[model samples]
Target chain A: MQHTISVLVKNEAGALSRMTNLFSARGYNIESLTVSTTLDTKYARATIVVTHCDDSVIEQILKQLHKLIPVIKVCDLTPENSTTLELVFIKVDSKNEVGELLKIAEAFGVKVIDVSPKTYTLQAVCNEKQLKSLVELLRPIGIKDIVRSGAVSINVKSE
Target chain B: MTNKIITKELTGSQVFLECLKNEGVDTIFGYPGGVILGIYEAFYHEKKIKHYLVRHEQAAIHAAEGYARVTGKCGVAIVTSGPGATNTITGIANAYLDGHPLVVFTGQVSASLIGNDAFQEADIVGITRSCSKHNYLVKDIKDLARVIKEAFYIANTGKKGPVVIDLAKNVLDAKIEFEYPKEVDLEGYNPTYKGNPKQISKALQLLCNAKRPAIISGGGVLSSEASEELTELAKLLNVPVATTLMGIGTYPMNDQMALGMLGMHGNYWANYAISNCDVLFSIGTRFNDRITGPSKEFAKNAQIIHIDIDPCSISKNVTANIPIVGDAKIVLQAMLEEFKAKNYEINKENKREWFEQIEEWKKQRVIPEIQSEKLHVHTVLEQIYEYTKEYEPIVATEVGQHQMWTAQAFNFTKPRKLLTSGGLGTMGFGFPAAMGACLADKNRLVLNIAGDGSIQMNIQELATCVEYNLPVKVMIMNNGYLGMVRQWQEKLFDRHYSETKISGPDFVKVAEAYGAKGIRIKKKEEIIPALKEAIEYQGPVFLDFIVEPFEMVYPWVLAGTPIDKVILSRKE
Candidate 1:
């Protein structure tokens, strides 16, 4: 099972490394992680994606995150109770992707962020399923490069 | 000028000592170096604080850990930057894993030269980031007082672990107001002290309803000083009580209800009880892999109700049916109250069948027998226990076969009597810890049971002990090998001893070279006399007891094996 956990931590030096070091120290898996300063400036939010974890392991990860001194809060965010978004960018051969790629991008609700002579970059910010399917559609067009912002989330109940 | 706030200005070093004094700390275990000279200079006029300079930076922290274990006070250690700071990492990790309260200070390069890699500078805060409960890098003189206060508070409170404070050299020379923080206010830190009343009641209900309930205690109970509460609860309920190595001496091993310890290398009956009991009520133990052989197979028939101070530890290894996050002492008190409300009584008939079953398993329990005419580790431990039991001595152990033998053979009736590194299993911890233990309480006897392979790790501490006049008695079981590793290779690796065989300097000569008493005992008849002389000696003494080289710790359960599935079938 894959679980997404968000940790709110005090904005300080080595705060993110604490999270990474903790995962490594406890032998916990981290598939993807994205960290950035929050709007509050004093705090930062880290979204960590862990795979092949049981419910008990996820519970421990959350509890251990809370144990970090700089951590203000930690929550396990599931797709059902939270709104998640991952911004992905995929670049492909512009000449070959000029016509059908735009059509496929339109169908998948992705934006053509850059269209240069050599490459065209497609962008999408959606939940995991939509992002995966969109990336698959672009793969046949000969992808040149790819980048993902991992996953960010907001608890719906909090709103 | 009318709205101005004024405070007395003092140098950074003055504030440093003042903060420790304000925190009620009078002793410092540390060493001096170029980067830490400012703080060392302040010690010249320091009347309240006494500093014990150790031979190595690592020994300083271990000594502090030993001090903390005995006194229930946060251990304080200070060391210089770079190599000096790096040396203490092992001790810091040991304290972190064992949950000892230690506040370690490491001097760093000037704040401006922090990332520039200046001479003798290391990012110790980042180095100890994961191992320490919390850490701080004092970039400004103004933040010094509050950081020190918070370091002390964080180390001593909640789960009780090490905290590191990396100080820049320039900051120590800078001027700051000498007002120590009156209180620590960490926004992200608040520990749960009182257990939920509903959860306590529910757990008590489960205990009352179960016919075969047992209590497994761990270091958290020792940390919380909840032995009295745990004793009462176990006695009143007439439930069998087993302890983890960290919880040894918390519940008297000789108690009829006491099943000794339960885990790898634990009591056979105790492990059997843990395997078969229906209601497993664990207090203060984290259920680490050492205690629970295979998480899935451990206590398969039991519904575990775990009470721990750290929430992260509750279900980290094994799932807890009822998890209560609070101080052990507080939760035990609440459980006691809940037990009273439920009119709990000692109804022996209800658990008569369970008791009979445990007794049956107890019949298979293994004891250390005099296998050969050669001196045995158990015999030495038993004789030492007999001689030292009257003083209520504190026993520290270097990790090896001797450590396990001491853990199983010695009977400790009080919490904090045994100070071995349970989680980290550190080898060199025993001697320095014994030194720290003696300094913590000068009157009580302090003993370090060591192995030939382990005693050499921190043998340099003999100088520190002799200089300070700390009468720390070190009994090295001279087995001529790393007994634990040798046992593993002998059993699992086709009787291939490999590199487990090791030789060391003559410990008695080494002790005497460091100006401490040294005694060598080769015959069984000399054990009593040597121990008496060492105990009577006014300074540090090292007793090298030559013992059988092939003895192994029994009742050992292989990792991932069921606790009841004892391999090797000792003395069958």
Candidate 2:
């Protein structure tokens, strides 16, 4: 199972390493992670997508994170309770299939960021599922390079 | 008086001592070196805090641990950077796992020279990150006081552990206006001291309903000073109390309900009760691999109620049917009140069968009593215990066969009476820990039961003991081999000793060279007299007893085996 955890941590020196050390020490897999300053300068938010952990492991992960002195808050985000987005840039080789690539990009609501004779770099902002589908559709056309901004999450209130 | 206003300027070194004074620290275990010269300079004229200079950087921390355990105050130590800082890692890791509170200051290279690989520089904070509760590198003079304050608070609070403060050379030399903070507000760390009322009520319900009840107390019982509460609860419920290695002395071993200790080397009846009990309520013990033979099989017939201060420890190794996350002292007190308020009757008849079963297990296959004429460590330990029992002496032990023998042989009757490295199993920890224990209380007879092999690790500390006249008796069990490893090799590794066999310098000569008395008991008849002489003598004494080489710790529970499936003797 996978869990996207958002951690608000104290913005202090060695805080980032301390937060990451917990995952490394436990041999937990960090599938993807993004860290940035929160609104308050004294703290920072880390959005991490972890793999291969169950409910018990998640509970342990949260508790362990809370144990670290620099960590301020930990939130285990599920798709239902939170809004998440991942930005991925896919550079296709084109291979004389420019029309097909553009069609595929448009269907996923992706933008044609760059174009060249040899490649077309398309940027997609969507959930993990749509990103996976977009990559699968472009794989046959040939992906020259790919880069992704891991999950960025925010909690949503229930009405 | 209150901490005065921050108007007076003080050197960083002065600020350091003042902060310690504010925290009620009067003693420090430390070693002076190149990087820590500034602090030493400040100490030259200081009279309030006395520093005990240990021979090795390692002993300094270990001694602090000894001091901390007996006194229940966070131990303090200071060491120079690079090798000095690195040497304390073992002690730091040892305290971290055993749940002892310590505040260790490591002198670092100047702030400008950091990462440039300056002389005597080491990235101690990064090195000790995993091993310590939390660590700090003070780059600025202003953060020094608060860092020290936070270090003490963090070390002494929650689960209680060692916190390292890597004091940069410049930070120590720089000037600042010192004002120690009265409170530390850490956002991430808030230990649950008061358990959830509903969960605790449910636990009480389980206790009230349990006919075959047993309690497994861990080091937390002593850490939270809840032995009184634990003892009361056990008496009220007519429950037997089995303790983990670190939990020894938390419950008096002589008590009828006391199960001594439960683990791989635990007593037979205790492990049997763990396997068969209907309700196994445990307090303050992390169910480490040693405590649980096979997690799935452990307490299989029981509904377990676990009380722990660390939330992560609950359901970590074994699932808890009712988990109350809180300090053992407070939670157990609450449970006692709830039980009393409800007026739950002690069902003595329902528990009669359980007690009878335990008694049968105890009589069936007791810990083996060898009738051999050859000198055994057990005999020497028994004599020492017999002599010191009336005094309520403190016993510390280094890891290995002797440590287990001490655990088996002694009847510890109070909390913090048995101080050993239970969690990390670090060898060479006992002797220095004894020095600290002695320093903490001059009234108690502090003894370090050591192995011939393990004592050599920090033998240089004899000089420190001699200089301070700490009167720490080091009783070495000389087996001419690392007995525990030899026992395992004989059984599991096909009689190959490997590197287990060892011999060293004459301990009598070593003691004489360090200006301490030394006695050797080579024959079986000499054990009692030598113990009497060592205990009665004034200064430090090293009593070396040559014991049988092949003796093993019985009631050996193999990994993945059920707790009840223990080998009673060597042949089994």
Candidate 3:
């Protein structure tokens, strides 16, 4: 099962590498990772979305993470009933299929964030599956560029 | 009187020097670089502190580890940021895994340009976080003195491991009031120092009752410098002693009851003893997979009594019937007293017969028969052992068949003398670690028995040895293949050799290239003479012995197999 993990770590050098090493060493695939400074100046919050691992494996990973001196805590945000979204910006050729692209964008509730003479940048805020479908549909019309922000998640209820 | 005032503007380099001196650090190993020029300027004038310019930052870290391992003191290293810091990653990890105390200082870009992607600003603290027990980033100049003191204390205390302090260029330049904190207040860093007396008494009772009892010692005993206590306990209990690869030198290898190494590549007698014993007492060792074979089948009939310094390591791998968590030195000392108080007598019912059986097994399987004209790995170990028989020199080795051979062949009667990277199994650990060990004990001869692949990993340390004029003998078992991996492939993969064969430059030439005396020996008769010549050489000397590639160390127990089910050489 795919699970979203939130890790609170000391804000220090090589922290990211350490996290990546932990995952890679155990043969765990990191589907997406987002890091930012937390409310505390001395700590950083990392939200990592991983896939196809059982609850026991996820618990093992968290236990291993706790073993690291810098890691303060690790939380599985999936169980907390949280809000999550993945951001993607894709540019497509708009000269020939402007109406068709606009219709598809309206159907998915995506916004045209940027526009050039021959390109239209569509911005979408959705889950990973929806993002994948959007990319697949736009591939027929020719996608000039695609940039994904992976995934960022937060719990709806405060701790 | 009111107008009298003094002013001095000191750079970060001056602060670094003052901070080190304040922390009572006597020596440091580092190499100067473009980013570390300011620190070098301060180092130039610091006559009170001795600094050795190592060939590489990695060697510098290992050198520190050597100094720390022997003296039980904090080893210190200084390096420039970016690649310089990154180069020491493996050494740091090795020390971290082995639980050695080390303090590393790296030069970072000035505070203003830290995130600007400036030259030599590679986020060293971030790079070393996973490898280090703890790390600090000196953002303010005022924090330098306190941070340096804390780094040393933290690295040397509790569960000892490497700790890094990344100093910003500006922090080294900015001057502030200097004061060193005498104590550290860490809530999460408490190490267990006292073993439970009840548990110790129970373990002693078990030892007294079992006719066939064995003590399996590991590297933790060496780290705690408790070999004396361990030896005393084993003798009092009248039990045979076996060691893991990491625990090589804990008990005198020549001792009558000593069964060299126990595990996959361990001695047959040791494996037999472990399988037949009624009680197994493990001390200062983490029963690694290589040592235990199949966890479920290992010592199935024996009751396990585990004693360790780290609580987390007590039952982390193998379940212990009696878990005593504390410092090895303290626990062993306590056990000795308890044994004396109880006046325990050795059980003699089956003890004599068991010992005789073990000795027979050793006579039959421990002694290797090398019939080939080519120099075998066992032959090299025997030659080295013969040469160093009187001295019992500190022998360090890299990860390979050579490492196993050294562990089995060499009689390490003294604890903390056989220094090798066991938990990490680092390839390039020998040369540099030997250099460190030699530096730690100037009177003792340090021998680095390394494989061709493992030697090339840290061959650059020869320059450091030459610079220090340290006499460290480098014996290379040139099998021209990744011996261990190849052995596994040959036995398990039906001899389908993929990328195990090593095709590279000659090791003798490579050793000479590093400004060290080198000798190449192809004849079997020349092994002793070459070893003697290398040992006699004043400075560092490398002897490359071209060994047979397919010769596998025997009495092997495949992973997950019981010790009794070992596949002997004749079976192969």
* Per-residue lDDT of candidate 1, residues B256-306 (tens digit): 899998888988889989999999999988888998988899999998999
What is the lDDT, from 0 to 100, of the residue A129 in candidate 3?
A: 80
Candidate 2: residue A24 lDDT (0-100): 91
Give the per-residue lDDT digits (tens) of candidate 3, residues B1-572: 67755546567678778767777778788987766788998887889888887888888888788777767788889999888988889889989888899999888888888888998779777777667888888889877777777788778765688999988877866776555567765533456788999999999888888977888988888778888898888887788899888777778887887888888888778888898889999998777888887777788889999988765566666778999988889989998887777777767765887777777887757446565778888877887899887776888888888888887788777766777787788888877778778767888888889898998887777778887887888888888899999988988899988899986577777767877888999887888788778878888888888888888877688877877766668345
lDDT, each prediction = 0.90, 0.90, 0.82
DockQ of each: 0.76, 0.76, 0.10
Q: For model 3, state the Cα shift of residue A30 in Å.
A: 13
Using TM-score as the measure, name the better of candidate 1 and candidate 3. 1
Error in Å for residue B452 of model 1: 1.3
**After superposition, which runs of candidate 2 have C-alpha atoms over 4 Å from their true positions?**
B1-7, B365-373
Clashing pairs in 3: A13-B125, A13-B126, A14-B126, A14-B127, B11-B173, B12-B172, B12-B173, B252-B413
For every candidate, what share of the true interface contacts is present? 0.76, 0.69, 0.07
DockQ of candidate 1, scored on C-alphas against the true complex (2 decimals): 0.76
TM-score of chain B of 1: 0.98
Lowest lDDT block of 10, candidate 1 chain B: B563-572
* Model 2 lDDT, residue B72, Cα: 97
Best by DockQ: 2
What does the lDDT read for residue B478 in candidate 1?
95
Clashing pairs in 2: none
Q: Clashing residue pairs in candidate 1, if any?
A: none
